[model samples]
Target: MKLQVTGSISELLTGISHLSEELNFTIGSDGYPISVVKRPGPIEVKNANGQGEICFEKKIHFYRALGLWLQNFEKSKEFHIVEHPQFETSGVMIDASRNAVLTTDGIQMLLRKMAVMGLNLAMLYTEDTYEVPEYPYFGYMRGRYSEIEIKICDDYAEELGIEMIPCIQTLAHLKEALKWNYSNEFRDTESILLAGEPKTYEFLRTIIKSATKPYRSNRIHIGMDEAHELGLGKYLELNGYHNRFEIMNQHLKQVIHITEDLDLKPMIWSDMYFRLASKVGNYYDKDATIPEEIIKMIPNVQMVYWDYYHTEESHYEKMLTMHKLLVDEPIFAGGLWTWNGIAPNYGKAFRTTEAALKANKKFGIKEVFATMWGDNGAETPIQTVLPGMQLYAEYTYHQEVGPEHLAERFEFCTGYHLEDFLLLNHFDETPGVMKDNLYESNPSKFLLWQDILIGLYDKNIEGFPIAQHYEKLIQPLHDAKGKNHDMNLLFHFYEELARVLSVKAELGINLKNAYDQADKDAVHACSEKLSSLRKDVEKLRLAHKKLWFSTNKPFGWEVLDIRYGGLLTRIHSAEERVQEWLDDPTVRIEELEAERLFYNGIYTFGEEGTLGRNLYHRIVSNSVFSD
Candidate 1:
């Protein structure tokens, strides 16, 4: 496979060599020199025995050509061609502020993967993760990135031809930062900045100056979305009642002025403008319109319409059309669906992103990006969402790339098959049930975290043969866990979680039935099962701890420890209660003997029906014996 690559296609060959080391290659020679000839449109590759000429109009097209070459070569098929990116700026945005800050090494690995995928942009969506020299407690106790760290990442991204931009909150989503004593003067309710305050603009100046210092790109994402109750907070107390939009517009202009003074172009989330202009709080309202006066009030900042939910192309078509009417050159931000729980929802991400990208292309949109948010605790590992990231890259360059080809390219880039990695998605899906609900309603997460004494989601597993599903996932995941030792630990955790769920789901019903009939033998059997499930729970906990520290920092593991530790204590209490009931017939196991337990479909954070908290609440709510 000896070949000579030209200057334009040299980087492409280097990328191929990084993926597959077996092929021997060279550059800038007479024998089969890979030439980059100018083509009118679309990337075309002419190859013979891995020796070829890549014909591309732009340098960016070389990556797509390289991807096509790798796909054909790996499959032992003929060479193929690809087209230009549908969106000019195609990339992924990582949520670094939501508890789990991605380590620098983890980020570098992703950058390498992104390079092979032909992605051109990356944004670290930081709320308070970056250092603010003036604010001491901005990212306090949260693993925020230092100036040196940011500079290193920027330099690395530049080497990979990726423009790493700073995406920080300017108006809202500053909840973490507002917790500090110093932030009291600047905060408008709890999350928004105080509008019409000179001190607020001073704080914004410090944030903008500190955040934009390390990044090479002059473009900054000034997040102004979801500031619903803008002026109603402290701003109202300071200044007489003014329209919320007016307050928002005034604040935005101030922020833009700061950015302009710093010689930076500002981009913002378009939801606030629409929310205020249409006088509708809903972000996806189709008939929402912005008044020309309000539109004129908006400064020269790039408007980013971040839509992550719509699975239909028509929804995106309408939204994108409306966004274009509101602002020029609107960038669409779709979700990769990694923030759900302990796993990435690849199924939903694929369906929705494909539709969104198609709509973006149809509208002739020039820029788009995918977001991997870590909403609650950032439980899911960033690596788990690689398949989703690869899909976004493929869709950007060539919309018609099928599953098989995408899988091959993914394996070449990441050393893991797409099917093997997609096992993460199965943790959330029920066997026979359609997962039409949002990521919050993931059954596997609920099953894993459900209480052993009172299984709320256990009864919901009617059609889902989850025990068999976990049994089937173990071997393939084990086989795929070759050199990726951390992945093996992760798989072991899920395997132990499945074992616990398999027994826990049935233990409650059996115990209840046995107590009703006063069957000593059945009670003893249930006791034995309880003992086994407790052991499985311990194993799962240890595996989870190991997996967590292996891939992430030790900052966020306390949350897991608290949740799992609570489960173990509840299990022990259940065991003691059941034993006391068995020893003395007079002991009232009334709650256990009560009518059949039913699955209540509830989804709210810190609520009774929520997945993780529900099980704990159930145990406390229906305790037959003292703890």
Candidate 2:
């Protein structure tokens, strides 16, 4: 399906070359009468008999129009597509701070896909994952992108018609940034910097200067969200008790002054304002109200209303109205569900993106981007969220998107089936999991990481054939891997993960049940299963290790190494205990004898009868994980 073009698309040739594997057809640039023309309106692709032109106003839209041109023409179908973009700016922000920073080449690979998907911006969310010149400990050994690495990525993105903006935390969420002994003097608590300290402002100025120097865009995301302990720590010791709102505003004013000095336009997370307005400090409290005086004092920075948990359009509309109360039109930041646990939760991502984007369209949000955060050590591969990315990219140009259309568009642009990428969602959407409870319940994570002897979530998931669920998922992921050779490494990780979870999901339940009944034969069988489970876990770890190194930096791999090592050691100890119990009935199996309580730790949504949990610390044990 090679198409010859009449006009030169030399500017996009570099990016297209980078994305050669995903392209189904070759372009000669001189033979096909299909030309590119700059128009003043919506992007249009008119293809009839493999000869037509792509009309687009913006440079990025040209690439997007080309995607439209190929979507139908490559499949031997005529296409006359017109796209009116709903948002002025549509893109994605990658969370690179949580131990899984993508290599420079990987960022380029993603940028190429973004160009074809009609996405125009990318934010590298690096809390402490980028370098600061003066401070050696600043992002030291955390796989922080050097200034050169960022410059290279920026150049690559620029060639692809994508704006790579610098997004960093100016205040709070800096626990990793200030974890070392060198940063102790400026810490308000563990993560929050002192609000008014001269040294704190100095640190902020240096880090802010370091963060934005590599990017061409003047737009920056200055994160000031989730600073729950704003003035309760050393800030109180330095300057007596003050209202949290006053402290926040004063700190914000100082930070804004720095951005203004740098000639940068900034946006801060709108959650802190909403959280402070509520009595219970909930960001989504419908009854929350902010005082008019405080709104006036807010500096002239764009408010980013990032809502990812809602399923209804009305919820987004309410929050958007609240943001408009502060500014005329706030930039909406929705999420693609890559942050949950071991797998991406597409059930939640699709539902929430559809609802949130609809609200954004109604509210006339000019700019919108989807956030793909890597929470909880970033266990899930970022590649698993391609379908979620397509969901956001599709909503940018069309008011209504059909399922078949999205699937076809994704397959054409990515060379991977939407249904196969979607099959990865079943890794988390097992039995006892309902659509109403998708984000909170990461059965794929907790069940895999849950202790064998302790049985933390075993009782809640009891009587459901959850083990059979993972067993059924293996071959489909295998088939998907065969079809998606480009991302087969990612598919292999999930396939092995399903293999491990299939056996380990109910291992503790079986062992504990037998121990309670004093069934010695069943206990012996559990010991043999433990030996095989260790091998399965090792296989899963190796599979994940291969995927991580191929896609990410080597620094964060150590954290997961510790997690896998802990699980293996714990399983080995469980085997020894079972053998000891089998050797002598007098020596009781104390761990299995304890009556399992209905447990839902406070780390996650502690709903009644819900087995949802995330975070490695909570999954590993009931005791304190680290000091």
Candidate 3:
């Protein structure tokens, strides 16, 4: 076990002796926080009851701190953690608004983990979930949460010393409720703004009112980020509103008004502020990113600066620029590393967290959130992210050493090999084939590439559709037609196939140019990158097979569709053909892309060819504007 302490000279020495007996290590004191290092030794104590204090960078030491309390249990009762002067607070925002819906069970499970980490704040970004009972149909299909379910989650969170902050995507991504065509508030205007109306302000007000009524937290995150498709043809035609910045600002002000009226403090995504900040360096151009309106108006409101890939030096640097820009308000947000259902990207997570701690000290960011997004619905379990979150909780709360020193502590807390644990716990499990590709490409790059590829795959959700469509096309290649061809599945397959192919092309180019000119370190890194990429491809193939084979006969859906699974599997020879490319990335990539084009060709045989029943229904149902 190792522990590093920082602070006043006296406090540092005192803290060391306080834990000397329990930690079974010797503390070599250096003047600064970075100087103190813990080494294994016989338990020793001297002058611990002094005026100075110490903090630990290693979590096992922190765990040992808690274990000290546990070990001194009187009879049958003891506290899991010793009470400290500073209370731990965590803020999380789950984007359930985007087609992904987290179940009540998932919410309960998340709250339980948050409490363990001493997280005191939680937010569920719901567009359709937790609709106001008075306006029952407001959210419709997209808004699936009931007030009862929300209250249940809310009550549990409160009990755990965590406040549940409900996040609502008021303006954009409101297509779920808009499709119902249930509101006439701004029905006449083109639906560019959001919620089926050009007048997005009013829609936001209604949502705010509904959410704030039951929840008591004054801080609410009104997600005004990613309004990319703003002020198009209709919005432009209505009043010559070509200026997106002006329009975005107007919408933000309107939302702010609603928040004020509700007697609540608003927390909006700080992308707009960061957008306006100086490009920091040549890598970022002001024109390519968010509008400047954010930087100008952010001081007036509380802001959350969110970036999940903080481990990347570039991202951390940008965050510093943003903090400098917004020298006002209680600025608090986290560097995100893991999201979606893929494994947690630990390398990025660890790098980002370490950066955040240094960042927190440098920029004075008071609060942070480690985001776990449900991008592709609840296809993967929320519990999968807990281990990674625990690592962050330790890093964020207990800070005494550098990033390298915390690594050993991480292995002890998680009970898994550091590399394998990071790869398995935080990244997508590379299917056997991906590993094979790396071994074939460059044996030296085997370990690093495998690990890196897992993280990349976790972030990418293309495997789901790639697997689904390939199965569809292969199932009845000779006989399938029209309605049987799932357009949604095919479109996703094409998109993902393109992305994967693009990455492969990029990798090939890098290998060709860099291999000859690279230094030893560069070559080793590149080899590892290639290996990881291969593993990602392998996992993609496996995911494809899993989805394709289960389309009709989903494992747990026997009660809902008894014949669906059987019918899907019955497509003679589909399974066998897919299995053939399971061991080959090149073949897997080629066949999937070919199948995507084939599916596209089948649908677009002629310019105005009559559409199949399935396509027809999808087109019509998806075309109309809703409330």
Most accurate candidate by TM-score: 2
Off by over 4 Å in 3: 1-68, 71-88, 98-100, 183-199, 273-299, 312-318, 330-332, 335-342, 400-627
- The residue pairs found clashing in candidate 2 are 4-32, 5-32
lDDT of 3: 0.44
Q: Alpha-carbon error at 414 in model 2, in Å? A: 1.1
Residue-level lDDT tens digits of model 3 in 96-174: 6544456665576566545434455678877666676556676555536767777777766655456888787655555
**What are the RMSD figures for all models against the true structure?**
4.2, 1.6, 15.8
TM-score of each: 0.88, 0.97, 0.56
In terms of lDDT, model 2 sits at 0.86
Q: What is the lDDT of residue 537 in candidate 1?
A: 85
Q: Give the Å error, residue 553, model 1.
A: 2.6
lDDT of each: 0.74, 0.86, 0.44
State residue 30's C-alpha deviation in candidate 1, in Å: 12
Give me the displacement of residue 125 in model 2, in angstroms.
0.4
Model 1 accuracy (lDDT, Cα): 0.74
lDDT of 2 by residue, 178-289 (tens): 8998777889999899888888889888988899999999989999999999999998998889988888899999999999999999989989988999999999999999
Q: Give the least accurate 10-residue stretch of model 3, judged by summed lDDT.
A: 436-445
